[model samples]
Target chain A: MPRTSDGRERLIEAGVELFSQRPYGSIGVAELCTRAGVNKGSFYYFFASKEALALAVIDRHWTWQKGVWAGILDGSGSLLDRLRGLFDATAQMQVDAVTGTGWVAGCLFGNLALEVSSQNEPVRLRLQEIFDEQIAMIASRLASAVESGELQSVADVDGAAKAIVAQLEGLVLFAKVFNDPSQLDALWQNSLALLGLAPARA
Target chain B: MPRTSDGRERLIEAGVELFSQRPYGSIGVAELCTRAGVNKGSFYYFFASKEALALAVIDRHWTWQKGVWAGILDGSGSLLDRLRGLFDATAQMQVDAVTGTGWVAGCLFGNLALEVSSQNEPVRLRLQEIFDEQIAMIASRLASAVESGELQSVADVDGAAKAIVAQLEGLVLFAKVFNDPSQLDALWQNSLALLGLAPARA
Candidate 1:
């Protein structure tokens, strides 16, 4: 049996899979242990409690997602193209998920934000920090866009960034509710419009 | 003790309270029974299972919400003013909730759409139907806006309406996450901009 740190890795892997596919409240640690192929005792040996494990899972998931967003947002291209790339990446991920799982698993941060934020204070506070970090990154990119003249100046850049992130999350929720990944199709245009951007030069 | 239909009403009322405050999977029928002041037998008499009761709760919630939306959207006012009225009502309700409970409980439909949409098929389908109804109503109002020349015609009226609803839900999610009711303040402007409307005539 995997012991200690190895057991922790396997448990978090299982958690990301199960939690992303279903609501946090619906999933129990027993299923997580079973899925991870670890015993219940091993599960507790690694984490303090289910909510503790959830906090860990949030950290793990955000690390992976931030890398993905970085690859899209931080890569070489025009700012508009890069932002569009981020939307494309999001849409492609949804497409892949629907192709593989027949369901669009929305963003996990957003999942927890709506589902458990009110019930779990620690998790909600962590999620708030993550959201603030994300909005700041997006605000930096928006500031770059304004500096490069790709977009006009926004009144409140962070506020606009928050709106963009919120809309992206909302579209993902729409995709999940409708079970149609194509619901993400309008993200690039809508996001640009939300930021008051002009049509990007081809 | 409430009997028959009265018991059902009480159970649904309790469901709306608890589920909106917490989550569906975290809430149990026994607790629901306790909250409703009814017995487990009476609860089982109305709902075959907790999920069934959730379905009833969704129905009841939507009926009440649709009335609220109608009062804002269908009542006498300009389309822009009516739209602004909808946002105002939403913010006021969140303010009221935060003041009453110190927690900003987001939209129940939106909460369930994220939490249970993947795990429960019936509830997801019902939510999809409810969202379609909402988007259609918003689209009709958008159409009226185009006819009245309050705004230019949108290429995709339904899509624009969906965007508006998505942003509204997003703002509510932001509110819940930040534990700040002011997060809903941007809905009026963001939504109008989404619909391709000029600054609303003050």
Candidate 2:
């Protein structure tokens, strides 16, 4: 009885919810269909396989996350302020997940990146691209910070960006494992340190 | 028949191998038993469940890893030198795994922390303790580094230790996802930055 196109969207929503909540290997297509209120026929009608649906969920998540990152990173004050804004938002999402779902939904990409990267090549390739973009975004901002005189200069700007992003993923793991968002409180100071800037300025 | 205790060790070995190679949810007791060359009866005799076997595997892995960490960190030259030693060993393990298994076997605790931390309570608690001990070990080293005048002082020794560990975990995630041990090359410089020290000495 649902709209024809609703099936595809619902499948992705279910994929996001289920994948984020548990390991990717544990989630089944039948369960995905049930959660989406789409029958098996409709499920197959949209996605060639569960992997296809997972790729869709991944694309959808990146699209939304990319928008949020662009909005904050683009509309920001100083580079530190904008980066702080991004970290604040990142921490808040974990808090929100705990409040809403009673579980800290860790970084969906990072979670999948670890869970499926070795077993699933398509998923792994997509995740690699996603992480690369994340690093590039931060690297671009750091370059601007140096140009604007907020930073003296960065040696190996891309490496710094990768380190910052790596730190974020690591803290997010702690947040998920410890079930504590405050674990992320160090992001601002640590980000400053990585950039060779004093936190007194932050 | 094999030695009476070999079954237990074999099961734990299989857990380490299979669990690291794929998501935990997809690996079942039967697969573990077959891989260990232990029959079904012997498996239940050794482990109450797959999760139980996983915990045993975790303990064994930590036992070996903690020894390596303590051996490097507890001995050697400056804090920077020891930390570099630890990072090099960590990267080398991934390299070895790639050479032997054609896949990076990321930190077992970290991989499971993200995968089963929410779903399995006992495993979650054990992992929490392991990570806390890891943080504690590094914090103790940083404290000694300060006492010995390696640097002026550390503002938040524990926080810095946690950040360094987090950065390590983040970079490990990259190493696993990107399938490159070189991703961890940032550990030494980034650890210095986190500690409010310069990397020129590193």
lDDT of 2 by residue, B48-152 (tens): 888889889999989988999999998869888998899999999999999998888888888998888779989988988999999999999988887888855
Q: Tens digits of per-residue lDDT for model 1 on A58-117?
A: 999989988988887889988878888888888888888878888898888898999988
Q: Candidate 2: misplaced stretches above 4 Å?
A: A1-3, A199-202, B1-3, B199-202
Residue pairs whose backbone atoms clash in candidate 1: none
Cα lDDT tens digits for candidate 2, A1-202: 5549988999999999999888888889999999999899889889999999999999999999999999999984988889999999999999998998877889999999888888898998999999999999988988888788887647677888898999999999988898888888888888877777752112
Model 1 quality (TM-score):
0.95
Q: Tell me the chain A TM-score of model 2.
A: 0.95
Each candidate's DockQ score against the native complex? 0.49, 0.55
DockQ of 1: 0.49
> Relative to the unseen true structure, what is the C-alpha lDDT of residue A145 in candidate 2, on a scale of 0 to 100?
80
Evaluated against the true structure, the overall lDDT of model 1 is 0.85
Clashes of each: 0, 0
